[model samples]
Target: MLRLQSALGIFALLLLAFALAENRRAVSLRQAAIGLVATFATAILLMKVPVVARAFGAINDAVGAISAASRAGSSFVFGYVGGGALPFDLKVPGADFILAFQALPIVLVMSVLTTLLFYWRVLPPIVRGMAWLLERTLGVGGAVGLSTAANIFLGMVEAPLFVRPYLSQMSRSELFLVMTGGMAGIAGTVLVLYATLLAPLIPDAAAHFVIASVLGAPAAILVSLIMVPETSVRRTGGTLEDPEMEVASTMDAIVKGTGAGIELLINIVAMLLVLVALVYLVNAMLGLLPNVGGAAISLQRLLGLVMAPVCWLMGLPWDQAVTAGSLMGTKTVLNELIAYVDFSKLPADALDPRSRLIMLYAMCGFANFASLGIMIGGLGVMAPERREEINALGLKSIVSGTLTTCLMGAVVGVLS
Candidate 1:
């Protein structure tokens, strides 16, 4: 039953993308087919290949090491609340764990490490290699290829910075591909943060988040191709340029990266507080409404009814659809952080292992309305001339990104 739903879900999702196509006739079957093949192949390579699986395991261990290192820094500043030995005995195990002091600092450490790696020329080669493979696989130019490949590790706004010179030259379809790529993947900084959050709930979570990002890239391309097929000729005039400025030294890179991460930390903190509070506020308002079948009509319940079918189609059992749907809906509407937090708090029996795994893939993206604004604002500054065009495609990119991840979930459902 799970396999049948997952297999059928792929076609259903493709058809939905087709139905949303700007020019249905322009959608290329060859591109979409290659994308599907690439996504599955990437997943199999990362998850099933023994050598690669062992490497992924090593990476997960490294994530643990990185977390411990961050806690060392935090422990000095914030003491035991950050992760040090407790001065007082705890009545409840791990009740002392604090998100601000412990989990969020991973962003700071990762930001510095990513900058050092890039500044030392370690990341450029790997990014360039990924770009080359993406170009060969997806038939994209250097600009789109670099942007999409980088989005696997970099944030949506930061990834496109590498291809800033070519932004004005990309076709609408190619431009949409960049936007969709950002929507479908999470940044490495947050990857560690999330992996830390879910490490207890899901084994080797850093590897899973990494695999989710890998799976998202090709799926983003396929969905973007379906929605806004290439109608204009792209002008690829030169080599890919990394717009990252040169730092004086590794110290400079660490200082600058920490500064950049501070901004992200503040934004994440503020946004989560506001959005989560608003969700509860709205839920309280909703509490006044009449009950349905003896169940309270909260936002989660409403979203579950709407998105359960979507999750079900992604191969979750019918009994768990509402639960999975709530997480998906929260990720789409609020953000993945909140959704994943709620998922972590679920009882052991709330979702089976398969359903939990599927939800992880489905919710691994920046597809909410919030991201649309950020993309528009960031791209507007990066290429002011393309502001109108960016505005035009902003809303549709959300749907493109959301469907892309859902397709990924369905693919994982089949393989898992």
Candidate 2:
């Protein structure tokens, strides 16, 4: 019965994309079919096949080791606040951890490691290989495919830089795909941070987040194509470029990586501080309103009211749909970090196992209002010539990206 709902959720999401398609007649059913199949296949392979499942499980271990290493650096600098022994005993759950000191620092470690890996020629081949698969399966050109594939590991803003030279040359559909992929996926630099925050709550949280991004790729591409079908026949070049090669030495990599990580960390901290407060402010404003159904009309409740059906279609039971939708709403309006923090604070029994897993995947994206602006500004800078066109597609990309991740959650529900 849950599987049936999951199946319907997938079609409903695709139908939403079709309804918003710039050229509905140009939508490629063959491409969409392949994407749907790829999303499910990727999930099954990563979670079901013994050998591959073990690999993802190893990823869980790897993330733990890496998180400890990050704590080493952070703990040295920040002392107890960064994850060292606490002076006071905690009675409540999740009170000891500090987001700024502990989890956000993981970005610095990841950035440095990522730079060294890229410098050592590790990530390029993997990205190229993935892009190759995307090109073959998703029917996107190499440059666009490479950029979209890179979003699995890189942030939305950073992924387009992989195909920086080709931005202006890419067709509108291809550009939309690039943006949609960025919105649909999260960065590896922050993946550990999220996993660390979620570790105590979800088993193999790291592995699940990794799979979320992996599965999200095809879903993003599928929805992108559906929303903005490729109407042009422009040829896209295959060359992939990276600033990593420009690094002078190991020290250079560390310095540059640390600098990049610091910027990301600062940005994340700032956004969290401001956005969480803004949500509070908004709820405060809403507090003046009269109660409805014995509950105040807070932002979460209102959002939950609107999103409950959507979450229900993704296989969360109706009884739990409001709770799940509230989280999804928090993710959409406040950003996934805040949503995750809120999710982590929920009582364990608030959501059943299936609902918890489904919500995790569904909320895994940069589909908030903030990201929409970021996408517009970032792409506008990269390809000034296409700024107007990009502006036109920004809202569509968010919708597409949101649907993409929800579709992935639906797939997870069906398979589970």
Candidate 3:
């Protein structure tokens, strides 16, 4: 039954993309088949193969160590508020500061560490290798391949810097692929923070997130290709122009990375504050509406109603589908951060282990409405000539990205 649902989910996503294609006649079945099979095979290797699983295990241990190191720094600076022992003991019965001081600081530490590693020419090789593999396996242009691979570690705006020279020359389909890749994958800077938030529920949360980002890259390209097939000829797998790299030293890299991380931290905190308050305000307004079964219905309930069908198609039973659907809606409407916060707070009995796992993967992406604006602002600045095009394709890319993440969830469900 789970396998059947997974198959149906895949078919539904493919058909939906085809139905929404700007050039339906241009949609290539051969290309779609290759992409779908590649994505499925990648998922299997990451999740099912024992050798690959062990590799991921080793990587997870490293991430765990990073988390510990970040905590050590956080404890030193913020003291007990950062999940450490209180400097001076006092009986204050309250929860530790998890979000502001603990989980969020990991982003800052990772940003510095990642920047230092990039300065040492560590990440470029990995990004280029993945991009090269994608180019060979999926027959995509280098610009799209490189941007997609870089999105695994960097922000949507920052990743495009790797292929900035080619952005103006890319076809509509290639630009769309780039957009979808950024939307579909989470940055490494925040991966550990999310893992920290979700670790209680999912013991191997860092590994799960790593797998999602890896699987999402190819899936993003597949959906983009189907939605907007390239009509014009473009170069495939060529040398990337080295942007004038400038970092005075490792210290400079760390300083700049930490500054960038502070900006991200501020954005995250403010965004969540405004969004959460908006949700509250909307729910309060909704409270005045007539109740069903003598219970007040809010935005989440409405969103749940709309999204429940999608959850059902993804193999969630009806009894659990509504709650899972709410999380999906929250993810798409708000950002994944808020949705994850809500998910972690869900009662233990609200969802079974399988349903919870499926929803976790399904809701793991940056395909919300806010991200569309960010992409336009960030990517637009790089190539002002393409701003209009970016705006035009924003909605389509979001749809493609959302479908990609959910499809990933379905595939994992089948294998599980």
Q: Considering summed lDDT, which 10 consecutive residues are worst modelled in model 1?
A: 234-243
Once superposed on the true structure, which residue ranges of model 1 sit more than 4 Å away at CA?
53-133, 236-288, 291-300
lDDT of 2 by residue, 143-193 (tens): 777777667766676667556546787889999999999999987656777
In candidate 1, list every pair of residues with a backbone clash: none
- State how far residue 71 of model 3 sits from its true place (Å): 12
Backbone N/Cα/C clashes per model: 0, 0, 0
Ranked by TM-score, the better of candidates 1 and 2 is 2
Number of the top TM-score candidate:
2
lDDT of each: 0.79, 0.79, 0.76
Please report the TM-score between candidate 2 and the true structure: 0.76
lDDT of 3 by residue, 1-416 (tens): 87688678778878888888999888888888999998989898887765775575565566567667888998899888887896665663234546678766775776677677667876556555654776667878666787787676555655665565467777888899999998888766567667777888986787788888788877887888999987887543444443343578988988887786676566655654665577678889989989976878876677668878778777777888888888988787777877888888999988887777777788878887667666775567556799899889998887888888888888877877
Model 3 quality (TM-score): 0.75
- Work out the TM-score per prediction: 0.75, 0.76, 0.75
lDDT of 1 by residue, 1-416 (tens): 89789989989999999999999998889988998888889888877875775564564466567667888999999999887899988996447778679866776776677678767777556555755666677877666877887677666776775565467778888889999999998866468767777888887777789888877877898899999998876554234555465678989988987886676566656644665577678888999999987977787677668889989999998889988898887787677877888899999998998888888899999887556655776676557799899889987998899899999999989988
**Position 378, candidate 2: lDDT:** 57
